[model samples]
Target: MASENMEISLPLELHPFVIRVLDDPDLQQRLASIVEAKAFVEESLKVAAEQEIPLNAEILASTLRPDPLGLGRFTSAPLQMDNWPPIGWLPTRTVQSQDGTPAFDWVWFGPHRHSRPFFEEDVRRAEAMPFNWLFRVRTGLQALISGYGSEPEVPLKGLIFHMSRCGSTLLSQMYASVPDSLVSSEPEPLGGVIQWIRLAKVDQESAITVMRAIVAALGRDSGTGAKYHLIKAEAWNAHSIALFRNAFPSVNWVFLYRNSIEVLVSLLRQPAIHTVENLMPREMVELNDEEPRSREEFAALVVAKIGKSIITHQHLGGGLVIAYPDIIDAATTSIP
Candidate 1:
């Protein structure tokens, strides 16, 4: 295809080529079949060159990635594109705009191939892929430019929230077992967007727009032609249940609660991040302050606030209150 001696014309941006590859069923299938990381990138580059997509190493290597030392990160060149296609990419985190506005840091995720217990875990794997390491990180208003007016390919059917040590993951796993389901458990990007809204980093209009847009982008169907999408939010996120309900008025949700003693004991054995004194803010769980509270006390208060918040907002949306026992019953009950 391209050679050192050949003077090939390269495009100003790489999103169009990436979109073409991801949107084409045959091209995506062939690329997805490559098990070797290097081979995947090589093949993708080859295909781009063959299609005269103006492929070049300078642009390919410019994709963002984590540095080996974990000190900071490797950066990508600024990409110039009008509107981004939602087929293959997803927002990884939230960033600040030059004008102090909130924005998303988009990344290449290829397509949804596997459903991990947590959506962030699936995204982490995608980020590590050699194919994805070639992603372009465009600056300024990528969210607004990408899928601004589009709806999710798959329909969001349910939202699962829970108290710590509950059966939320198991519930999501069951949904994931169904072949036509797209389930994202505790996605990081959703949390990021929520944080922006909570902090008023984005105005209400833009907040709703990005929040809806990100969920739609995540709901994109993989090759399985998945029809249903569900998200199991982080346990601490129960504090923001009202915000979520307001954002997705029609989406049904369930909050899974467990015995306080059981949840306390579980957290005592192994403390979750939210259980730590300063890790999560007191305002989040409705505590007066972080001081004077032991680990056990902190866990108890957080769980209580989470439950209270959920109960308060349960009337909104099509909210359902489900206990941990009910989750167990639904999961373990065998058909006669």
Candidate 2:
């Protein structure tokens, strides 16, 4: 066994050929050697386990934790070739992951995890699952999907998209009441993927891959006999209707809207970040920002654009439309 602090020396002249080895045919040979090395390493681990050495406990008990402060990948020199793609859920941001990669970072949230109800408890718990501190595990996305060896959780019971201030939360709460249903309301990572896809100009195929991995990761059965999984998306996510529909075409969805006046008034009383003037893309809204409207007008205009996007999706037969007043009836009758 190698000593804990034993320093291993390497040939200084190997630097020039390092890139050649990384980018050439010998890479296959190098990969094969790594596989052999890992087998020996695993054998050592097995021996250690047989001896009851508790070798991993120190690292496991400390850094890697459930409800980690964030998730990220290792991306610096002194490259850890032995642990390529060293991604994990971490209890702190002390170690930064590769920035601008097709990856995600998560922070713990409490309110989202509320437990019981029409779907209130279920949605709250599932949405908050990302924030829960539990034993941590890390795997590359492709490896994760390959290990599953099957298609992702599909035909999710339904999706709920809304114009803010509508009864979206109430609807999700009701769904939580259903027996064995898991409701994920406004999950941030899912929302982030949409933004990343657009702002990062990520290709559609890669975006789909990332989206599938995220939903699959979060879509695990809640171990409470959950038979249905419902996702309530963020309000502005209505704009990404095409991408979302393409990803989950079979999933039934509802778009909830309310009176523009009511939405504007609600925003005025309790402002949200999105209600600020010019907060959204100018190309998307063509707003007259030079002579901005009052906060209420700006809020109303944002709501109108969201409603218009939802309506377009509905008109194209991607989802059903329900006015705020009709949500309860629609929920009781249409949703199983």
Candidate 3:
């Protein structure tokens, strides 16, 4: 966070910095390595400063994340976490706080109407409020297990898996369209914890415990609804099917896939964060540290990797497979 007295102003010339920080691979790598949030901001300001790109804390802060649920006067009033309601706090990221214990940072996503492709577009907005940097809060890993605000009555309906550019979001949306159902597509905290688990940042028992906590939080039941809980994991998350299965054995699941040629065309036209180099860890997608022949080729391999993982795990008892063309029908008839 910039000093409160640092003249909260963003120069016109620095407007492009927002787009650059999120879209530029090198810039993301440079900032992501910083363990401390404040240090991260300071380094970001310096990057723009050294390049002679006019910038201020405000401008830089706005591009750090998605959803403007920060504790600004203009934003929603935040309820204290002491007895926090499940619906009020949205888990934003899984992080190890200054204490070195793994935890999750939460933000507000009120009843406000939101943009589509929630994680992709909303997170990409880089929408941040200065207040967020000043007073962010973290719910320790135990809160997830100690019984969050409240747990939904029903067990998870099913998990939604997909190759990106496929109809996973569409199907999840369809499920959300139904009355009393809550479909969270590409949950960031879940994705974040999965990465950390793979990186060995957390032990196995704790990882399983927190994952259950996360799902329970997402499945919060406020006494009346969300009888159906469906989470659409990221394309690369196919590799974690066993993790989810281990943590949620009885929960049903479905994997949606599409034609590779069409998937490649979609990526070539507009690359997703996972497909872009440095945006995501290569090891998460089974790629070696050596340079890929091409970004396009790398993306294809990533898509193939996800497909192979899906094939390897789709036979996990309750799991079902659905092709892109048959998604709507499959979701309608196949998902119970």
Put down candidate 1 lDDT per residue, 35-111, tens digits, no spaces: 45556657877898888886665665554343332122223223323354335656565555566544554445555
lDDT of 2 by residue, 1-336 (tens): 111221112223322222232233333132222213234234434444554443443322232222222333242221122111111111111232356543332222212222232322333232233112211122233433342314334226688888888899899889877766667777655665566667677787777766666665455432345667788887778887877777766777888888878888888898765677666554334243534457766777777778778766675564788899988898888655
Please, what is the whole-model Cα lDDT of each candidate in the order they appear?
Answer: 0.65, 0.51, 0.64
- Residue-wise C-alpha lDDT for candidate 3, range 5-124, written one tens digit per residue: 121223354445544553343554465445455666788778877767666776555544433443332332222233323342356566664565456665433332122455534332
- Candidate 3 wrongly placed segments (more than 4 Å): 1-87, 99-101, 109-116, 119-136, 148-154, 201-203, 289-291
The alpha-carbon deviation from the true structure for residue 5 of candidate 3, after best TM-score superposition, in angstroms, is 30
Q: After superposition, how far is residue 120 of candidate 3 from its true place, in Å?
A: 6.6
Question: Model 2, residue 160: what's the lDDT?
Answer: 85
**RMSD to the native, candidate 3?**
12.8
Ranking by TM-score: 1, 3, 2
Q: How far out, in Å, is residue 159 in model 1?
A: 0.8
